[model samples]
Target: MSKKILVWFRNDLRLHDNEMLVEAIAKSDEILPVYCFDPRQFELTNYHSIKTGAKRAQFLVESVAALRQSLQSYGGDILILNGKPEELLPALVSEHEIAEVYHHREVASEETAISTQIEDLLWKQKVNLKHFIGHTLYNKEDLPFPIKDIPDVFTQFKKKTERDAIVKPCFLTPDAISFVTVQDWGILPELSELVVNEDIEGLSQDSEFKGGEEEALNHLHDFLHTGEGMALANASLKKNEIVSKLSPWLALGCLSPREVYWKMKEAEANYGLKPYFNQIVLGLLWRDYYRFMFKKYRNTFFKPEGFKQELALVPLADSELLHSWKTGNTGHLLVDAMMQELNATGYINTAARQLVATYLVYELKVNWVMGAAYFEEKLIDYCPASNWGNWATVAGVGNDQRLTSSFDFQKQLKIVDPKGAYAQAARA
Candidate 1:
């Protein structure tokens, strides 16, 4: 009898450098990969009005569909389920006589809770559960500083690890799985199946990228190997230009950071090194830092006080102002444009995220937690730690060096987004 292994597919979507998939293939005679489209994700939120909005939901469905195709090409299959993993996984395990469950470790309240319950149940079944860290370039064990004692500020954290940190190289995937067997499968739920909002929406014409590992790899090549790659990097480094545009892919686990980092390094070798490596690497580091923060702080990072307790409370913005911000009717062109982009495409550049978050907390006097929740629902790369930590830091609540301040919308419009191109484009 072949030893059955269940690969619990979560954010780490791709086949390449997929630690969990690689390990599962090695350990099991037959591999069964499963992706659960948890229904709760599409429900409405109290603050944002809509939970998973149309654009993001559409992108997620598309990405999962792409993943299914990719797995089929490699002589395997992704069993699609449309319920909570805790409720679904045990039944599948018993039916398959699964020997093990292999999955990537996630660091969020809800995600961890599900993982914990699954782990406990598997233990009772005598099924071995293995978890690998495939999400970030720097593994938790590989970090120079203990996660518990990580620096409070980005500068200190970066300075200590910049020279000492060694990013583990990527591992090549096996050519193919020996056997392909799926007992039963079902269709993915439509947008209306999970979402309550009656309005059906498509990606706004501005969205240039699609969800999938294929598009992600193509983007890496375009960003790193091609002529446009160097240009985008150059422009983005100088002023946060249309560089790479890989955040959504990176966020969705369509592309691994290791894959991107390797490609970027190779591009540097081919095109000659530039000063922007530091800036680009810093963004990658931000991703790593958030993961670390999440593991260390757990659900506390989701709250207003974050890691620090005893912080003074400020009056939060009422629902009226938050609605204005979410609807892109705040009258601040740059802020409005950024929110509109997020609403239409499920993404915003790092620069835009920082500026808009600052505006919400300091200028509008809105709670940063609300902004974080809105991002959580809409963003393609909504890692809990990164999203909440970044917002809290910007809101003067998290590990921050800069004083609590607000950006002047008019000044930001003239400077960061001169000529009102972004504003005009989003408004249109």
Candidate 2:
């Protein structure tokens, strides 16, 4: 009997630097790749927003479609299904005689819960489930300090890790995959099937961002070689031009952070790491910090108080206020413009994100979780740790040492968008 393995695709969607996929290929005679579109992700949240709104749903759809195509090119096909993994995997194992399941480990509470449920189910069938870490720039084991001892401050964590920790080289993409035949490789779900709003088409059509590994690599190359690299390194540079805009692909695991890190290192060697390349590495470091924080804090990271009890009164959710913020009708030019851009393109630069989040939590006085939840729905690159952790920090409950943090929208507008180019473009 041949050893048949199932590669479960989750947040880590790309083939390049995919450890789980490589492991499956090495250990099994036949591999079956699978992706599940869990219905729960598309449901409404407590904040009355669809958990996965149309913009993100469309991106996800595009990503999965690309994954399937990539697999097919390797002479393998991904069995894309619309169901919970726990309910679906057991049947797949039984039908295909799958001997093992391999996947990337997810530390977030909800993802961990689902993984645990699937593990228990697979265990009952006497099949093994293996998990590998592929999300962060640095492996947890390679970190200079233990996860529990990871510095609560970003600068402290950044310094130690940059000085002491080592980033392992990325895994190789397989040349060809030997696939086990799957009869019911279901079709990718349409936006309407995912319960996405009809208005998404109009919003996404004008947006240049597309979801796929190919696109991710292309963006990386363009950013590094084509002067976009220099823009990424300069903090004083405008958001529209300076940032790499790689977060969406990174968030979806369509691109590995390790690949990004290595590429940036190459650029640094040639260009010198003074401002441009150093800044890019700093951004990757910040992402790793949030992931480690999630591992250390777990579900507490999502709470309004966020691993601390210092906040006396977390704001209650206000439907009208949230609606105004979400719709970009809050009457603050900069905040409204950022929100409009986010709603339409499912993306915004880090500065814009911080400004809008600060406005929602401070000026509008709405609960931070509501704003976070909305971001979860809207962002093309929404990673649980980075999104919620940043929200908590801005909400005065996370790792920031300061008791309160708020951005001055007008002041930021003057500095970053003096002539209001961003605001004007967003409105247009």
Candidate 3:
């Protein structure tokens, strides 16, 4: 009998640079790609925030649809299922006679929990669930230090890793996939079918975060091959012109960091663009550091006090202050405008995010976890490692607490939105 494999799609949604997809095709005579739209993801959190907000839900729907279309073009298709992976994968495994399952590894507690459950159940059926580390720019094993010994400070980690480590080339996109033909692959749901399509005029109507691999590649292409990214490469441009908001796609694994890195190098070689490219490269490194830190420290990043020390700068609770901050009535024009932008568009540039998040922690003296949770609910680009890790760092209890924690919001606001142009856009 031919060795059949079931490839489980988690966040690493795209075919390009997807390790599991490449592995499944190579090792198995027949392959089936499956993505589960878990109801748990759409449920509410303890903080009363929708676990996956509508904008994010919509983006996911579009991404999955695009993936299916991409797969079809390659003589394959992804099984679009609407249930928990733990409940659904076992049945698929047995029904399809799958010998093994492949998926990308995750670091966060809840995601890991599901992975563990699926592994245990698969083991009971005499099948193995294999994990590949494809999320980071540098593979986990390629880091200069092990997860436990990575530097507590970002600069230290970055310097050491830059000096010693190397980013492996991305896995090539498969030209064709040999698929196990199933009678039904199921229907992809519309955004409204997945989440309540709210009349959320509060979120940014102008923000365009298109989902899926094609759009992601388009964004990267425009950034490098076209003028938007190249214009920022000018040595004289202010940092404000460099709004590389690729996080939404990166967060969902629609685009791989290594792909971005190599492409930036390609752009440099072709255009001799200035090294503002390194700024974005450093951002990729930061994302890797957070994921590695999450793997090292785990749930401590989620706690109010954090794992380092009791960082009780203020009481961790919801109050009128938090309400004002959330509603964009905080009375600080810069902070209010940034918050308004985040609410309206499901995104804010890096400066805006730092200013507003820092304001919530130090200036308003509100609970940082609540602020992070709000970001989790609102950001279309929300990733567990980056979101909570950033919050803990800003709250001064993360791995780099020894480093300076807060930013000069006023100074930053004047630079990024000096004329209050973004503020006017948010308020208008």
Which candidate leads in lDDT? Answer: 2
Give the deviation of candidate 1 from the true structure as CA RMSD.
2.7
How close to the true structure is residue 371 of candidate 3, measured as C-alpha lDDT? 88
Candidate 3's error at 74, in angstroms? Answer: 2.0
| lDDT (Cα, tens digit) per residue for candidate 3, span 1-428 | 99999998889989899988998999999999999999888776766467777788878887898999999997878999999999999999989899999998999999999999999999999999999988899988888898899888888999999999998898999987899989999998766566643554453435478789999999999888766665656555654477678899999999999999999888888877655578789789989999999999899999887866644456656688899998799887768877877777788877777778888877888878888888988888999999999888777777786744355556667867888887787666
lDDT of 1 by residue, 286-340 (tens): 8888788777767776677765577776544447788898888899877888888
TM-score of each: 0.91, 0.93, 0.94
Alpha-carbon lDDT, every model: 0.76, 0.85, 0.84
Model 1: residue 154 alpha-carbon error in angstroms = 1.3
Candidate 2 per-residue lDDT, tens place, 150-221, comes to 988888899999899899999999987999987778899888888644464465455677888998999998
Instruction: Give the poorly placed runs of model 3, Cα more than 4 Å off.
Output: 196-207, 233-236, 313-316, 411-428
Collision count for each candidate, in order:
2, 1, 4
Question: Candidate 3: worst 10 consecutive residues by lDDT?
Answer: 196-205
Could you give the C-alpha RMSD of every candidate to the true structure, in order shown?
2.7, 2.5, 2.3
- The best-first sequence of candidates by lDDT reads 2, 3, 1
